[model samples]
Target: MGFWSTLFGGGSPQEKAARIAAKAEARAQREAEELAEKAAKTDGLFERALGKDPENCSYDARQKAAIKLVLANETAKGREAWLSISRDYPNELAHALEQVGVCYHLEKNYRAALENYEAAIRVGADAGHLADNMAEARKGMAAIG
Candidate 1:
């Protein structure tokens, strides 16, 4: 019935395996819940995801929050978060700008999207695939006209 029983008792190996699996699943669930709770404690959604002390949160922390918000379809919020962080972390501006462009593009603000993508490239987010994203924004702008 318990770990001691599973380990020391004469239970079948299958039962022991199942118990171990259930315990592992429970532990994973508990850890996930704890992380979610920690992310929920801040004021706004972005802040909450970042933590209560965003000012002290690292660049990676802010980046993770932004990415999570975007993936969750809170793109506008994610863009805002990225923009806010970029001001303080100019070195990360290129990546943040690219994300902002993506948000604007999704919202059909094609011109803003194109501008941001261009800015991202200019600021050294100049990876080859970034060009593809910029081209998509350009296509969107053209389609609008």
Candidate 2:
């Protein structure tokens, strides 16, 4: 119908297949680049998070490692790292619990998310943010049920 379509043989099955394949390849290339970029950043973050040695990791390093794991989508590891020192640092504990809840929510584990949020509240995290997160987790759980 259009001049460009006519010139490009828009009705041709072979042309459509070629275009689709090319699009898919382009998408794959973009995804690969994105993944590589994410890996590079995560690697740097992990290195910083493990400063000195494994046996003598600092509190700051542990905190950073928890954050890094969350960023890298290693939710379980991140959650554990956060929980490990949560009691020692109430503020951080609250923050960590809230973040872990968010990660669980993203993974569609609404029960875990709700549990984390509740723990955050119990640990006296920022009341405002924790309350909001708890409400959201509850909503997510309800939606699933």
Candidate 3:
């Protein structure tokens, strides 16, 4: 076999292709397994943060747990958690809406981010605090358009 052939596994064209394909499949499998493990770990952390009785937890505790998920880069999950909190705790609706807006912002859904941010302000979030974030969302929207 030539140097190239030997270096590339010393096989016929079809054999080399098969070897490459097998290697790619194995790599994909490994990646999938790693992702699954990571998801499990994240879920465990989320569950622990929420405690055994999430429904009985205070709004502050629930909000902290949701914020943890966002800090961990689980934006979608964090958004969902915040939305749930908003529904379950009317007193804290503005803050929860603001957090959901933040998650949408992180995900680059500028329109949704703006909508949520506005909703938060209307519901009682400090407009001064949310102004920068709303500006950023507007910038993102302008860029995409």
Candidate number with greatest TM-score: 3
Q: After aligning candidate 2 to the native by TM-score, how far in Å is the CA of 141 from where it should be?
A: 1.0
Q: 68-123 in candidate 2: lDDT tens per residue?
A: 77877877656666666565555577777887787787688988988888887787
- Of the two candidates 2 and 3, the one with more favorable lDDT, higher being better, is 3
Instruction: Tell me the whole-model lDDT of each prediction, alpha carbons only.
Output: 0.79, 0.73, 0.85
Give the per-residue Cα lDDT of candidate 3 at 8.
Answer: 68
List model 3 lDDT by residue over 1-145, tens digit each: 8898777678778998998999999999999999999888678646634443456377666777788789989998888788777777788899988998999999999999999999999999999999999999999999999
Residue 32 Cα positional deviation in candidate 1, in Å, after optimal superposition:
23
Writing each residue's lDDT as its tens digit, candidate 1 over 19-67 gives 8899999999999998788556423558833444557478877778777
Backbone clash total, candidate 3: 0
Collision pairs in model 2: none
Per-candidate clashes, comma-separated? 0, 0, 0
- Name the regions of candidate 2 deviating beyond 4 angstroms: 1-33, 50-81, 84-91
